[model samples]
Target: MTKKDDIVQGEGTKSGGLSRRGFLGATALAGIGGATGLGSLVMTRESFAAAAEEARNNYVVHPGELDEYYGFWSGGHSGEVRVMGVPSMRELMRIPVFNVDSATGWGITNESKDVLGHDNTFLNGDAHHPHVSMTDGRYDGKYLFINDKANTRVARIRLDIMKCDKITTVPNVQAIHGLRLQKVPKTNYVFCNAEYVIPHPNEGSDMENMENHFTMFNAIDAETMEVAFQVIVDGNLDNTDADYTGRYACSTCYNSEKALDLAGTMRNDRDWAVVFHIERIEKAVKDGSYKTIGDSKVPVLDGRKGSDFTRYIPVPKNPHGLNTSPDGKYFMAAGKLSPTVTIIAIDKLDDLFAGNLNEERDVVVGEPELGLGPLHTTFDGRGNAYTTLFIDSQVAKWNIEDAIRHYNGEQVDYLRQKLDVHYQPGHNHASLTESRDADGKWLVVLSKFSKDRFLPVGPLHPENDQLIDISGEEMKLVHDGPTFAEPHDCILVRRDQIQTKKIYERDDPFFASAREQAEKDGITLEADNKVIRDGNKVRVYMTSIAPQFMLTEFKVKQGDEVTVYVTNLDTIEDVTHGFCMVNHGVSMEISPQQTASVTFTADKPGVHWYYCNWFCHALHMEMVGRMLVEKA
Candidate 1:
């Protein structure tokens, strides 16, 4: 096995022979094989800072230190949500959501265009699956949500000022992809997953009737971001999961031959994994039995084929990640073109939704082949199960009840260690592996092509993530990093379950509509500075503190409609402050006791310069301010 480990385990199969499906079509064109021993399993040099200070699964922080976990990434297509820190992966904060941020003027603030939708009018976004927001199944540091597979939308954020407060737009879905929440009574649902299959009145009258194209399974309203019912199901939802007695949830439904291309979605060798049954889709949405399509008033129901709240099951090739298993007993399902990982048995999903199981693959109970391209799975609360594979760039680590005692034939080996990851890994997460407190330390992976690992930065390649340690019994690779844009997925949380907030408490329902329009124009954003014109519409009102900006100058006029607002007044929690109006692309961010707004329209008359882009102290470029404008 050492001809560069047979070209990194596959030049279309050799080492152990037989992989079939033409070795996944030679692992979908597996080229780029480099293996410089994945840089000796990431030990950078000099005993890699003494094996990261004798490993406690620490990634080392220093400089006023702090970071025991908080990750929450997704930022894919950079629609934004970053916030890292776990085992020192650093990155700290991004949030923006559905694009347009320029330092913090998220979509150029008017309180983020009243939460990105006074007609969101698209600024570009993609952000896939971020999560966080759970309760009895853990992590509840308030909210996180995410997912905007480029505008099928679903924002949320607000885990105590991490920002993004609410976006919604899930009407009948189109590519909301897969999102998850509701792990028991507390989360009250967020679900999601619409991934293509249009024409339900998508207006174009079923062009050639692609099986009347479908897609739906939404469910928002984890505190009113609305749309609380959708279901529809049958295939074409990608990755989603939930289980901990909130009556189930789970997705993975590859093209199920709704066929549109890519060889008619691999013409099924089995493609399913639905599940659903959240109290019978909430008693078929409180007995209205469900319908309403175009002009979505939510309630869709009909969990496809024999629905009474779905079951589907099938699964093999084409199923792509639908995890679960954190001692809530199993739901695995990877198998993107098969290497296997079915698993199933969450107490046999109440005996396969009570039709007394016996097939629906008998609520699955383990399939296990695990290799080649098993797409995604994670969990470690001791019964293992890492699984990333993606055409064998590796991360297997098996063992769920010894792969159900080797699928019940009991010769039990369950393949444990695979490691390698550097090229094409698509999602692998561990710490708190999907709730029930799954603390198996750390394990990130992500990959999806980082070409030569780092420092080429040209043909667009910066996604290597890595970071392992999986708390012993082997799986080391501790930290490789790189990441940018294609963040696609990430979640760790446990900086004592993230309780954040050292400032911004004053009237904060996140700037409570800019403190209810500065209490209807009498303006007292804590000692307001004042401007307030109101005809061509002005309203200035500044404040700050570090290195000034309590007005300093503010005029308006030329085609008015200004706005401004500011208000940091430094309560000293990292004294934040930033306003940037220069050449008017208008910026924002005023943290401390916070209050922000932005408007922008003096339509360019003169003396713009507003400054203070967040630095905060020692005359930080003299914080500055000017805005004048008058000349209409």
Candidate 2:
């Protein structure tokens, strides 16, 4: 191999030494080469210049300006959801879902504990995917759902207040990894995939039986946060996606061999992308054609090998992510072990389900070779696809129509530009790619290993979330954001698509219970500053206007159970208040025009003071209240 070929292959190669740079060079290059030259040669120096200049204008969000797109990222090990501004890559907010945050008093507050169950639940979560709600293939922005791969749970956050309102644990399933929302008609269902296989009941009765071990495909009611049904499919599930028509939802099933060993799981030459008939499954649930398994009352349907509710399409080795194209034409299943992506036509799926198509391969329209370890695929509305080549550490940009033409035995070159990433990249998403209006303006590359990308902060390094301007013909990497731990997956939507309220509503359902408590005790939360004693419990009803609390002092007996409720009556925006009791492990947010409460035992209390932690007015430091704990 030549020096150029050596440099390319030294990185990685697949399907007979086929490197994207070398392939593009041998196909389109006479002499021009390298990153800059390849850009100019492909799109011509003049057009490339215009595209490059426009890309520079995409990222620079000046002071007092808002971003054009909102990015919802899954905080992998941290067990939270992070919202960042697209193009700018600036972290806007962190919505604590399954994780414990002492700063915002997420786990300490009674309001938060109501959402997070008070039972034997641990404060840990491994969030994998975050998908926004949709309406008829468009972002409705009502809610955002995220899956906890660590704890078999899913949590939904309200878009208006940007707080987690509900969290539901998926019974009879472990490791809820892949997650997606419905598309057409509305996102009525939130689909979650069970990654690990465990025997039902897990009572050690069938300890060594591999056949009894299987995972499930779960569909959750988006509004109720309840498990609607579970479909038992073949093998372990990895990633999943829904179609625009809302008739089908497909998941990539690895370990089709159903073996306990790692080598046995990868023994198959090809795995299956199991597609579920949503309408038929709904019918089965309605007709009571399912059975309850273990302690979970969730209706479980057998969609394994020969079930009519699901059809297993044989795909290349170890299929990973199942992504539907924006135009609703094809479903691209990335080959995690192989170097190609199998494109299955969505229109032919109806024929396969109707038994008109004899073979499962009849649904496959194209199997174009992209690069080594093609894990996930995203689309640009202009009939092009950008796939994350994991082993190759590159993003392959290819025309979808050209790939279909090339897969049809044409000699056309479907390979476009392949840009090198920092390290191993995983899931990459384009702007509005999940909705009908996939404008394809920007792309976010989530690189798993950020080696040498940022300053080394000890052994554990941050992930590299790179932003690319896909508005032009060539994809240009604009910014590199050093993210916390790992952000597994993310989705981008237009900023205008999401409508957030500046201040919390007084009648918001998030704190409706707290409001009801004040009404039960004949206390006006908006103006009352009353303290009532009931047995060994003290109810401190307080209000905050701006710089001072309405109840400046309240006396309670030591060793008494105290429930302090603080209501912020400020009607202005950005006047969020926080109640933090000194040395009491208590802190909670009370947004403007909102009421929040926290419960704690006054065991070792002397004269503990509570203050507003969030900055508000000039006398913010004066916003303190004393809790005088008398000797019991």
Candidate 3:
């Protein structure tokens, strides 16, 4: 018997009601010369450029800014979670992930109970951190989908109740690092990126037979709780082909020996004969890079053949996060290895699949201004996009519609400029929400690290410190208190209430103070924030409502050493409170009923929130608050 027949018989080829040798030969033929043929048919750059220009000429202005919300929720190392409020850019809330002990100030209480419940329950050896989160406004406007990487499970959280419910386990997968939800009118599919798998050590001896596999895609039926389809991007092709009465060839090396072995055994079977040699040719072509060919070489099943999949667009490296545009016209993917955001036109997917074999359809956004390292990104209601810069500990914004217009040939240099950069060093995941306070104006809530922390700059600049500042043209700092500890993941608490206010009414105090300081420093404070209409400035304060009692409010003119006084008014025992200003870099813990004061300098204006580091607070989900700072 030939080498292929020997291996097939050794593995009991027909025991499972399938002929292994026949299947391997067929697959080899289908994959040969497939990708190369696809690549040669793509549109040239000049054609794409002309098409882009034509698209702009026919473009019609949108009536109003897009009205969809984007959220970023990250897990923390110390069990603290935070969400960023986009556009306005502020902290929505910070909640504890574990319960703390009152006596020893060590050992969290009920360590298994996550703030969101069963869905967020701590695994056998797991701890709370902002691991993964998703949002589906259709299910419920105030609900968020989250996954605990440590536990390898998915769950749902209700923003209104701050509670979580465990969902079904994502089937046929392990180590889900990133996931995307595709809504197909009547059906919704969740595509999960599974763990990387290397070939078994023993397979190296038979390099031609060794297999390295990654879960290409898994289709889950949300309604039936069934795994509808599973595709292995890389696998032992013989296993699949055998069942189909086809032949497959080794993908590791291009040679006739492997092909001849299978062909000799399956020659008597017409179905097997057609499959074996065909697959061998395909495999030779794919593995050899089409450098050499023989008479046995045959065409393979390439999606790009005779299609428009030839166009190439750049995609970020190690894409771990993904989201689609509100209008479903665009899709965005975030890279983990490098700082890069890729935008893809969804309408082109079919064309991409048709001819662009080995080509990725995507465009790089904000490449020139900021170094790429985006971990997660979400869209705000006003056509702007927000992304978290993991390495920089900062959040960046982009105008999607403006970006598309630029990609499609519109020229707007200012829109191309990167306007806002909020530096919250050591920051992780974040989310955005739009709500109205008592004043009847839209408020952006951002959640982030509330501890006195610092990230290393590098060996050369070891002392370089970073802090997230939420102050900008369309952003401001509002309120703050002790409600977080190494805080990470957060999402906006969306509500239906609407409120409107005169813009200047919110800017007078900060503008006036900034103007005074700028004049003293021999600099001019720009006539911004409508200073004349409402007054010269605005008053901004933060209130904390957990672990103890405190309402910290102060004017920007007071300098950075703002004092916060705490009183123990609640009946709860052993409950202590503390406040830490991240940007100012100072913290103090206050005991119950006794007024204690802490002071820190606010050198920069941005959104900062505090959380209770004490135990037994994660269950309440009330250990944090919001603070907004402006140019003072």
Candidate 4:
């Protein structure tokens, strides 16, 4: 089937808009047949692309509002949600809520109606301490589904009224983390991962085994809120108890008592799973030097799938967030507690069922050398993929098309070498929403987790535990303003598009004069600014102001080559800055008082933020400027 056809099948629509069929396609099955035969499992590349295309059309690509950008804040003690406005990075709104244990994850259901006077879910409950990992899906744009860590229940929230409709408890589920809505035929189902669950030896025994049976996928019905199918992921089991005990012990076994302490005590003597690196344990076994003793090696119990769960895979850690590309051609999974993201060709899904999946087919993406942690991920319009970092509190943007192009040997490097890395400390779970500027260019917004530091008040407080700026090469600290105490999530809002005739007829004659003066001064134009209309075009000049930091802005018209001279100005604080236009295809960094120049034609016009690229400097928050580009 063609991509267009797949859209019809997956989204259940002929027109490129939301329909009952589109809702079904997004929530129900892509086609009628189930995964019964080998032919059904083996999907050709063309068919997969079609399915992805159909899924893409269901979403309405609205222009983003600069003022409606939603962000979450958690200051060690309390938490609130804040909306940031454009033109100026000011806080537009703040909804304060007290006693929030920890804001794990959040999602905006497209219900359009208000719930609890709010559309977002805080993911807190009575029995559980409100640990929500991730949330997704808006069936008929009314119901919001979230996975709760503390309760292991999938909370179905009514978005129109903004109230908790019902919480469906997943039986035998423990430490549930990520929740995703997968559309089957007629009904929409939820696929979730039960990260870890404690299994007792007999009944009320003190000993607990960190069982692998917890990692299973569940299919849920959206309308009725019922579970359709439950599938356990078990790869292979080769070695006997001795080999597994010595090799995979760290990955599997954990003291149930210790887990309770960290997570806080639970009601039912339930055992909590311990977190560890499984790949390291496997290496020790392969070398034949794995230590086996009463304490060294724990007994391996048969999981739900028998030995399938205990099998070893090339990827070294526990997989956390799992998602498919918009095109459904690739499946991506991240290793929990480790900084690696793995991409698997979906065509290989059948291998898992055949018991012949190869570890070499998986490509692991990581920057272990740089201490970056890859956590939750979401896709944007231009086929680019963005992943969040739990440890560093930053976002990494990867070019999926380029990665695939390089994988296909089309080019040695497929990415434009232009990376727009943004820094938002404590940035944990994130989602993407696209919007267009008055000029019709696409922009993406990122939500982050910003919280206040929890300081120890005793005399024994470590002096070495001071705050350090380490944003690294890709991202610079832009604004350290007190706008946020703890930002947990963010969503991009597109502003309404401005007509061409209205832009030229605006009352601001100063903007037009600035363009004429810059040209009369014998300055060559480079590009137009997106947020500002000082003039149609401005002259490019270079200056050296700060060491390893660049200070620059733009001037532009409807159509003209604009030049921006960037200089490194030496400021009072130790900070580095760089300039980049991700969509316009321009960027460079300069040293303090040093200068660099880049020229690019303003082919695409939109509002984009250019900020500092280095992690140094205390007032790093003050390093932000905007550009507004008009049509030529």
Best by TM-score: 2
RMSD of each: 19.1, 4.1, 25.2, 26.5
Candidate 1 positional error at 33, Å: 35
TM-score per candidate, in order? Answer: 0.38, 0.93, 0.40, 0.40
For model 2, the superposed segments whose C-alpha errors exceed 4 Å read 1-54
Separately for all candidates shown, the number of backbone clashes (residues 3 or more apart, or on different chains) is: 1, 0, 82, 82
lDDT tens per residue, model 2, 225-329: 889999998898989989989899999999988887889988989999999999999999999999998677899999988899999999989899899999999
Error of 4 at 4 (Å): 50
Predicted model with the maximum lDDT: 2
* Candidate 2 CA-lDDT value: 0.86
The alpha-carbon lDDT assigned to residue 349 of candidate 1 equals: 80
Where is the poorest 10-residue window by lDDT in model 4?
A: 236-245
Q: What is the lDDT of residue 602 in candidate 4?
A: 69
**Model 4 regions lying over 4 Å from their true place:** 1-140, 183-187, 200-202, 209-216, 227-314, 335-340, 351-371, 389-393, 405-411, 414-632
Error of 3 at 394 (Å): 4.0
Superior by lDDT: candidate 2 or candidate 3: 2
For candidate 4, write residues 16-111 as lDDT tens digits.
454543333322222222321212422333443453344334332345634322222222113333434432345543332222311110112111
